[model samples]
Target: MKKISIIFILFLCISISFEAKSQSFVGLRGGINIPSVNYTNFVRGPIVTGFRNEFFIAPSFGVSYRNMQSEKIGVQIDLNYSTKGWGQLTLLETNTFITRINYLELPFYLHWQLIGKKKLKFFVDAGVYVAWALSAEQEIANDVDLVENQIIYSVEKDNRGDFGIYAGAGVSYDFSIFILQLDGNFKSGFANILPVNPFIKENPPISTNQVPSVQLSVLFPISKD
Candidate 1:
């Protein structure tokens, strides 16, 4: 009986030590999104209609939670308010037009720690995300010098949802009580997002959406098992 009791206590101690080494984490994340469009052209559109795009900086903010199942592998989940769009602007002219679409997205990432030390870890993350469109909007400025009569257009019907794949690489620094991650991520959309200018159901003005960004996220431990 004494030998059996000792063995059980030793096992419990080993389990507790293992649990203490890996703690689950929660954090806040934010990034800048640069959106671009790829045309699925069946009929060639006008040259002027083709957007001369410049990176329109958009904001993405979210909450991230991580579950560490082992020393080198884990899962990350995030819920975010993300924006996508492009702008048509001529450098020589003041007239400008911009389109923006917003989404509420949930992304699930499979995280692999490739290399690590006590203070830092390098990781690769891959995942898929599903998003619902919150709204689509357009802003137009015919002439910048004149007393501005700006037009804001509300898109009534757009592709309502999107599903996509994401992949990224990052490094995380441990502060003991908190962690900071810096990652560069690319996301590719798998479906059409459009009302396609003339509301053409058969063909869209633009074929699909593209979103790519670099993110900085900070995390805290909610509880340790």
Candidate 2:
């Protein structure tokens, strides 16, 4: 599956390069992420809460190309990395655990302009995302120290890949030389690729989860004509 996704991304890049003969832009963006985990069982509350609270502002950067200079629609491909996680205390006394999940995401979305030739234009985007887990770690702190005593409840580092749907809306101002944009996006996952270890089930179903994000970016034109 990983190989297939990588190939798909490469194919998209090639296709975009061929179509965007005179359109290309590179930019840098920084933003905040509010991510929450969802579980399959509706009968129970989320296995985790306040997962989004643990995260601070995360930074991202990407490049894009518009096929036709005057066209109001185009395709965009982005590569972004995000840091997100949560922590919790076990039922046992004197034991606490923290889980950190980091990911590298690739999103390909169709971009549409909602307003015509003004300095400020409204836009909407819809796309698919493939995320790879960089790492998952847990830290344990306990007052009593024993040779075989482990404060960490479960260290399942199996969550590796996720597929999600993404949608966003934003406004952009195009200067003769550069463009600036501010956007907010949401992503939800439908599959659980988390690896199962001593702490979690091998196939513990992970349901749709929401990841809300906001970004500010500045783009430089490679060709304005």
Q: Compare the candidates by lDDT and give the number of the best one.
A: 1
lDDT of 1: 0.71
Q: Which candidate is the best by TM-score?
A: 1
Tens digits of lDDT, candidate 2, 106-164: 77876778785768889998767878777665555454342122212122444577777
Candidate 1 similarity to native, TM-score: 0.75
Off by over 4 Å in 1: 1-22, 40-51, 89-94, 141-155, 195-206
Q: Clashing pairs in model 1?
A: none
Cα displacement (angstroms), candidate 2, residue 200, comes to: 8.4
Task: Please list the residue runs of candidate 2 whose C-alpha ends up more than 4 Å from where it truly belongs after superposition.
Answer: 1-22, 40-70, 86-98, 138-157, 195-204, 207-209
Shift in Å, residue 197, candidate 1: 12
Q: What is the C-alpha RMSD of each candidate to the true structure, in Å?
A: 11.4, 6.6
The C-alpha lDDT values of all candidates are 0.71, 0.60
Clashes of 2: 4
